[model samples]
Structure formats: C-alpha cells, structure tokens
Target: MVTPENVSSYIQQGLECEYIDVDGDGRHFEAVIVSKAFEGKGMLQQHQLVYRALGDRMEQIHALSMKTFTPEQWANQA
Candidate 1:
C-alpha cells in the first residue's frame, strides 16, 4: 500500500524540498511541493523533476497530481 507519507518520503529522498504536503488514498495522490529546484522552470519541467525523483516508485502510483512551486512562488501564493 502506497500511503501519502511513503510518496512524500520518496520525493524528499530524491529532491531537496522546502515544504511538501501529500494526500491520497492508496495509489492516487495529490502533492504540493516547494523547492528551489523548481525555480525558473516551467510547469511541465517541474513535474518532470518530480517524476525523476520518484524514479521506479512511480510505477506503484496509479495517479499523481502535483502543485510545484519555487520558494518565492510558494510564499506569494498566500
């Protein structure tokens, strides 16, 4: 069973995050990730970075929806 915690862990292991929140039921998940790595990247590129972070673990996930933001972007979202 792939819990939100597990997914969040996987992402954190592969990427450096300022903040990350994940919520899900088993295989489907939604994540909000804040990272410096996403700075100057487009949405698609940001997503790709996350996908790379997940690596082979992505296969276990049936669906993943993510909101990626740089530190500045995250701060201003409020």
Candidate 2:
C-alpha cells in the first residue's frame, strides 16, 4: 500500500524541494511542494515536472492535488 511518505519521496527524487508535505491515504493525496526549480516555470510545466518525478506512481495515485511553489513564492506566502 502506498502512503503519503511514498508519494513525497517520489516527488523529492527529481526535484530539489525546499519543503514537501503530502497528505492522504493510498489512493488520494494532496501535496504542498516548494522548490527553487519552479521559479520561472509556467503552471503546466511545473505540473509536468512533478508528474515526471512521480513517474509510474502517478498510475497508483487517484487524486493528487498539489500546491507547487518556488522558494521565493513560499517565502512570500509565509
């Protein structure tokens, strides 16, 4: 069974995230992912990057709602 941490770890593999918090059970998940890599990326590009990081795990995750932010963006949000 997949857990939040499993999803979190997947996203962390390819992205250099300042922070990552994932919530939910095996099928549904929500993530707050902060990374410097998202700085100049468009919404679609950012989402694609995250999706790529998840790779095959995307098949297992039924609902993945995410809030992606650059470090600068995150600082402003805080």
**Top lDDT prediction, candidate number:** 1
Candidate 1: 10-residue stretch with minimal lDDT: 69-78
- Per-structure clash totals for the candidates: 0, 0
lDDT of 1 by residue, 1-78 (tens): 999999999999999999999999998899999999999899999999999999999999999999999999999999
Q: What lDDT would each prediction earn against the true structure?
A: 0.98, 0.91
RMSD of 2: 0.8
Q: Clashing residue pairs, candidate 1?
A: none
lDDT by residue for model 2 (1-78), tens? 889999999999978889999998899999999988888998788889999998987998999999998888888995
Candidate 1 Cα deviation (angstroms), residue 45: 0.5
TM-score result, candidate 2: 0.94
The reply for model 1, stretches above 4 Å from the true place, is none
